[model samples]
Target: MSNKCKTAISVIGIVLSIALLAISAVLAEEAIIRPALAVTFTVISAILVFVAIFYAAKIDYETGVYECRKCGHTFKPTFKAYTLGAHTLSTRHLKCSGCGEKSWCKRKNRRV
Candidate 1:
């Protein structure tokens, strides 16, 4: 499997383990668990959700290969993780890879 798949599986396992621990703790001792612990868990869960979003938004660096539209030079366009979204890279300005030219390579990236 790829490194990405391995990392994803590890993250899923951690989340599942945390869930199981929470369930076991609640079932074992009703008095030991406090409201603060509940709030902490909530905060941790929210943070994890945001982290997941960031990870998903991160560019697949190994997969962003695109050709120059003008010169037809096949090259890998730099994969940038834009806060705006995937379409943010559709801007007019583009750097070419073949001749080191600063021209508009309007080609869209195909997922490989």
Candidate 2:
């Protein structure tokens, strides 16, 4: 599948998981669902959210390379670094492999 398609699916999964969790919370607060069942639903929804987020992170790491602003170098970060690094929607704080400068690097969909 295309990267865009994978990304979209992952995003949708996360959204659905959160929505399920919210619904469960509302049901429990309103006394519409049994407390035990609501707890079960909440746990299941939280697991789903974690799985979805992990999948999304995997897709992001696999599909794109980060470009260092300092040296105009493009590289793929280690999964640990990718996960731990601070980021905005399209940029991540990373140390450039070539220039050895730490900065917010832009994400590029193009292959490394």
Shift of residue 35 alpha carbon in model 1, Å: 5.5
Error of 2 at 66 (Å): 0.8
Query: Could you say which candidate leads in TM-score?
Result: 2
For residues 45-72, what per-residue lDDT tens digits would candidate 2 score against the true structure?
9999999999999999899899999999
Error of 2 at 106 (Å): 0.8
Off by over 4 Å in 1: 2-35, 79-93, 100-112
Q: Please report the TM-score between candidate 2 and the true structure.
A: 0.92
lDDT of 1 by residue, 1-112 (tens): 5546744755675576567556645744665557677566656665665565455444333434445556777666555422322333553345667877665545344443
Off by over 4 Å in 2: none
lDDT, candidates in the order shown: 0.53, 0.95
In TM-score terms, candidate 1 sits at: 0.40
TM-score for every candidate vs. truth?
Answer: 0.40, 0.92
Cα RMSD (Å) per model? 7.1, 1.5
